[model samples]
Target: MLTCVTRGLFIQLVFDCRRLRKMQPQQPGYSSSRAYLELIADLPWQKVSEERELDLRAAKESLDRDHYGLTKVKQRIIEYLAVRKLKPDARGPVLCFVGPPGVGKTSLATSIAKALNRKFIRISLGGVKDEADIRGHRRTYIGSMPGRLIDGLKRVSVNNPVMLLDEIDKTGSDVRGDPASALLEVLDPEQNKTFNDHYLNVPFDLSKVVFVATANRMQPIPPALLDRMEVIELPGYTPEEKLKIAMKHLLPRVLEQHGLSSAYLQIPEAVVKLIIERYTREAGVRNLERNLAALARAAAVKVAELDSTLRLGKEMQPITTTLLDSRLADGGEVEMEVIPMGQDISNTYENPSPMIVDEAMLEKVLGPPRFDDREAADRVSSPGVSVGLVWTSFGGEVQFVEATAMAGKGDLHLTGQLGDVIKESAQLALTWVRARSADLNLSPTSDINILESRDIHIHFPAGAVPKDGPSAGVTLVTSLVSLFSNRKVRADTAMTGEMTLRGLVLPVGGVKDKVLAAHRYGIKRVILPERNLKDLAEIPAPILAGIEILLVKRIEEVLGHAFENGFPLRLHSSL
Candidate 1:
């Protein structure tokens, strides 16, 4: 019996030893988890206590370390956090930063992440169309994984990372189902706490995450989704802003990035400003950054091309803006605008030092301006055509609305991709004009018959873009009235407001952008809603300085500003 028992015990012991060998790898301090731990260690996850969590004040100081202006944006961030603190939840709502690309949206996000005591992660959602992208794909037949949010959570190994959803509006939707719909649950305050992943089949608290989204156009955003976000507008940087950014941060970094230090190269302020206004035409400094990068690359390439020649010569000469211009001169001969930046020495070389990029060279590199406000300057006179200030997704634009009476059926013809509201506006204008036709002392009943039978075609340019909104009513009325009356609209003026059938000019929104657009068009006079006058302080001083802004309480003022003499109806005499 003892021998039999010993044999059984020996067999069990061999089995137990095999199990122990397998279990060793699963231990807390074992190799696999330890490997993950080591990975966390090697990363820049930890720093000296001295450089630890920066307060908002310190972060602001550091931000000033780079960007010179954008004080408003800095103030806005502080205000946002203050408002968030008073909210019911500790976590703040998502902030959607809307603006043209390159105006520092991503950088600002990074800055905010640093300002707050949080980790940062940016997930680009440009072409994300699948619902599975935001909500984890179910794990069944094949290898499935968690959504981007969950994956990002795993990456930072923390619940609260400042997550930037880049290009949220640009994300696509098709038969796969709108990925945006899945995000509704994630973005919603109440439901996000118990957000469940399909693969994990476990509820994860994502509420701690500070979410941010960026977009070029705010309109394309799903209305339901947009409601969850607190939007911040990052307007395109002005020429001055770009100039400041280039001088403060971009030029120095790009110099070192190309293996050229400040001691070796001197990029002039005029050269920087030239690049901002000429080479980069964005509301942001991103393109400025790209061109700067390109210029550096070109310089490096030339430096290499001339390297062999330099070896045969004596000393290296620093490149100046003038030297740069001369080297890159289109005529093939160096111009005086370019100069050398290095210590003066006898230098022998086959080729001159490359340019810092001249105005002409900038055109070749960055191409011509994508837009022109010159249309505003194109014409000085119009018989009936007038500049109507219209608001758009980009900003305010001055639209030319022309009206003419043609021999056709009394049916009114309208062109331009106008929406339902705009079409109604056109109709409303006709009604208002028809009622006042007799007051204008028209060709009596005979002219009224001709006017009724005549067809009027209205059009808005850039037909590819869909146009809507009721603010163009006053312009439509002025155009139609001018067309019928053969009166001229003021060439230097532009106007925007909604007109009620009662002839009251209702105040309109987007007043600031509209005024800027008008100013861009070289408009010396602007007819805006009187109620909007209170908002004038928001308009930039540079724009308001050049233009004569007139607020109107009635459509009478609009008509007064539009015509040199007056609307024919108003000009009617008591002879």
Candidate 2:
């Protein structure tokens, strides 16, 4: 059955199909025309999932039930639901969850659908480079179908289901066209009311559909497309958060999925802590969850083997037959009978013991610890090496900058898949250090520049992985200072900031992620630009409590905080 709008279109098409009487079923365009008609008939023009009354308390409970932590994100979701409850017809801004993988971005969108009692559909836009993927190819093209939106509506048989455009940042532009541009109309509240698809050849009413999107980063999303949505940033989980999630959500769920119970497979809290610290180093609990699942699988295999052995033993149990003398005496007939020993049978079977996950077991199943916190201390033990923090798509990571000097034409060499911004920052750091060589007491003689007689080479390890950004500015300078002074920076300290040619430090982005990275690496102290103190408020108090944060406004202060012995300036200097 078609709605009024579609019914009218169907009638018009029927009138135009009089030529079909002259054409055979095997004629050109016959199948496509027939498929188009079937699609029109099948589409849910007005059908909708009967939305249940919005219960804010129940919605909050649902969100909390499925996810742990994410207090800010949960609050934002509650507010969005509240707005929907207050004005059901209001055109609310599309919510776009931006976060690293395994941070529950997709699951939260699913929860919203459950809360609203709306049918849920996920349209994965990752690696979708063609515009046809969004708007559909024109009907003139053979084998064309409707866009993802229309096709999804047909699938759910609803005009107002909660639709998730997942991985929105992964879309790209090419000669075919930009899918992001096509999404502009679909996401825009004012324009989506009449969403047009090329194959459909008619505008579909998408105003009732509730759209939610997710992305790993916001930079790739078009500004115009991004403007139509409200972005909620979900940061990576702390160790404490990951532990709670593992114990409360991941473990039980994994065990049940593997057809085993905690009684059959036990993972102690200490073992889990070890997994978090040694086995995996990540911003999210995805790896942790996978490890837990692996343990569960191993335990399941053992349990299954035990069960099969018990079943084989039962099948092989010997039975002793005896003559029925009572029957022979009473009825004058003899019969052979097997005597059943109920109590004895119970004694022959024993319940299988649960498999416990321990450190040794972890090593066996997960191999040696993939990451070590002590690595930072060992790497920074020598002079000309310092730690810096930078953010990546996976989350924040600890970056080590190593600098050395050798005899050459005083040219600077930089390695490690660095970008232009970082290369420039390195040059700026070098220039700043060279200008302050005399004040820093680094000149061999009063008139000799530090780099005049030797070339400098700076290398960031993890050379295969691309590294960039200005946050490593101070780290580079500190490394150079350590190289010249032959004094090591504190192994326990890591710093991030942008430096100027005048020996001033500037604030940078991803301060929270950097701090988290430091925490993950067991770095006790972090040197951050003074301007980023406000950003620290977003970090959990527990994480901040464990690590000491030093805020600095200038490169001098950064150097002072970075080294165990203060970076002193000479009384007299060459200006």
Candidate 3:
């Protein structure tokens, strides 16, 4: 009975194809029908890539060779491979790499494909708003076609290729439809086994294909879609890590691309350090890589000029004494012979001396340093200016909050593209300060009310950019305290934490990123909530060694470290 049913379905498909083929070119459905048949024929229904035998050791080595210092991420990849090796048919969770740009997420995906010995395909979903992008447009549509997944498979000519959904989080919902919603079926293991596309109108098995995804952030991705994949957090690289990557991976690649070698262009480790610090302030080595590439390009041009000079000089050598001398003596033109290919150009002018990159060369090629370590110190020089650490999409940043007092109704004025939570935090900071004005000794005279006498205005610099989050709570209080007491917060110190009206400091998120940001800006001291001490364990030892981390249970402890003189708040009540 099953055989009869299968035969009937096969005969019906063949009959439909024949009828479509016999249709005339002027027929209403000829073009669409032809396209539909072409798509069906082109899809890799039975064709699959022959995967290599999995070797955990080799895979690890390949990952290390291509990327530098992602120990945990590499471990996760290895574990996934090991499972596949033990049971080739095992259903494993999809890997979703979440990190800032240029952290090698896409490259890591490529490396995985190489390790698995499968064809690789990348489907960019950066701005895909239409659901038809993930699931094909219906055949009833005039210009319908297969979705990105099926089309990618057809292009790679394999069903089991490693497919990367690049920039998955960038997909958004609209009147057309949500690409992310369509992706739900594509990424889910149970459902994806029989994934359906509207144009194909047939179930395709995606179980054999290895799917990997990359995103700049996790929050933008829908929770249902995010839950299907194993999330791996790739944090920003430290200066040391970037340095090693520049030397080991980026430098060699850049030199090769620009047609130069180390002998032609020598970039010392110290110069690379300067490039990392002075020119580029980023969470990833992307901009650093660009700077290095620029240096290489400059060196390439110089090398080419030197080569030309040597060639001309070498070609002239054979005629310098005889032909050119006689010609010049007679006031006649002299022509130099061209050096033929395969000649010993090595004998030509001793391989024009290598150009070593120095401070001057950096300034010449990349222009003046874009960032300075002294920015924090210079900004926090006056009272009411306090350095606060905040994490943004780009990673951690040192935000300087400035507060000043003016004679007006005692309302708080906030600026710098602040959000509601931060605005509330500012209000909370003001109320707390006013409530404890006696202990803080806000005014020299006891009879006068500071709140009634002055209005406070606070501004976060970089007004063009948006800033928010409750982590600024502690920093807001510090800025207000500095304003009322006329004392300057220590220029070398930065703090991040939430605060309560009761003056207790609460822990916040992104502790590691914040500390890294402080270190990036040359801050020697960092004040974090005492509860966030455990987060310090995740920070690299070298970073911690350079900066002093002070933990505070109360906001007063932050004030103690933030100022040269401890803020002595004498409590008068035992509530």
Candidate 4:
């Protein structure tokens, strides 16, 4: 019991109720505020830290030693972290790696975790549907767990941890805002400072957490959510890079895991390359790792099964091409007589050659190339069809641009899921061609005139897939010019650039991807805007060694060179 409101200077010193602790009712029927305060005090309060690193030097070393060939990707990562170091106030950059699966999105995330001393958590959202998956449920829901972001923090017991949100683009919107939208608060550097946890009932600063997101596509991302994050594209590994990664990391790990350790488990670089090119088709090493796992398991089982059949030796030996070839025909028709791999063998009794593999073995194992060397040439050549080199996260590919002018009502039609940017690009190309038609020795018919008299439609193939980006300008214009002028651009050449109505060609991005696409398509020559020549510095010397790169400032220069027969490009009034 306490008396609180009393005159103090009147020499009436009474018990100060404000200074007295609230007493828990000792009576039989007791209900008190003390019970509620006890519950609140007992609630778990976790201590957290925002910026923690494992070991920056070690992370860099691990990346260099673990993977091969993606020098650009590793370099980009360093630059990203460097920016973070420069601005410690900013949370670690939100990285969105756009690339084909298996190139090492998940692996690199782990490496980054180990490099930094902070805890690391990886969550896959490939098919996540519930917004509650990201934003925690209200405490009213029974047995509801905290959303991924909060749970990650509590488990790590730190404010800052590397939380890899895999496949953020796949995060969908439903009755509740998309899980991606929930990321708005957590990922936003401004609002995350007061990130309130429903259960904790206290605002916890979350700006310290480092968030990284990965996806195979960028188009699906909501603009509002995407604006808050930094996107880092992880490029696919080249064949050489794949082979080296296998030899350096995958093969040894598989062999050790399968109990075929030591030098005896050696897989030759050539065979590893063969496995990568034939058995796997991805930007990353996941496929190659799985294939290697299969091979290692198979080798272990084979050796175990063959133990009593043949005399054993104390020393383990590497499985040569001979043994690998023999295993390929293990349960097949070639069982009757072993096919020898190496050249030259003779015996008096028509000795069957022992099963061994060489270049010729590519056919038996992979069942002929999925594609042929002359596949490009085998395609039927059409009047306005032209090959365009375009780059994707999967590296580069040769894209075909087919222009067809059909007999229809006077109208301009375009199809093939072209995005706004690309659609605008096609229109620009058309305007450029119409203005310079006379110079290329073709009728200069504007779209308005053409629609009034004749109908024309242009399309980029592969309709099921959405296509955008503005690097297709030159391809469209060249195809149209070739069709009207009745000429053919070199079958082995590809071009990519943006064109203007005034006939002045402007530079576009994806120069490296375009060049790579050309190389992949067996094109000997490529045409890019002269301005993009600076981007060529990113190109590896080995990849671009034999290819011819032609930089053009004007569409007219491309006209004479791209077409088979040289025609003086008509000087447009604007030109």
Maximum-TM-score candidate:
2
lDDT of 4: 0.67
Candidate 1: residue 107 lDDT (0-100): 82
The TM-score, computed over Cα atoms with residue i paired to residue i, of candidate 1 is: 0.74
Tell me the TM-score of model 2.
0.93
Q: Candidate 3: which stretches are off by over 4 Å?
A: 1-12, 310-349, 443-449, 572-575
Model 2, span 1-575: residue lDDT tens: 44546677767778646656566898998888778877888899878889889999999988888999899999999999999999999988899998878899999999999999999999999999999999998989978988888899999999999999999999999999999999999988888888889988778889999999999888789899999999998899999989899999999899989999978999999999999998777888899999999998888889888889888988896654445555555676555587676547665677767788888998999889988878988998899999999888888899999999999999999999999999999999998888888788787555677887789999999999988778899999999999999999999999999888776788888787788888889999999989998999999999999999999988888888888878888866554
lDDT per residue, candidate 1, 104-136, as tens digits?
A: 778888877777667889998999998888887
The global Cα lDDT (0 to 1) of model 1 is: 0.70
- Which 10 residues in a row give candidate 3 its minimum summed lDDT? 1-10
Clash totals in order? 14, 0, 0, 14
RMSD each, Å: 11.9, 3.7, 4.5, 12.2
TM, every model = 0.74, 0.93, 0.90, 0.73
Report the C-alpha displacement of residue 494, candidate 2, in angstroms: 0.6
Candidates 2 and 3, the one with greater TM-score? 2
Query: Candidate 3, TM-score vs. the true structure?
Result: 0.90
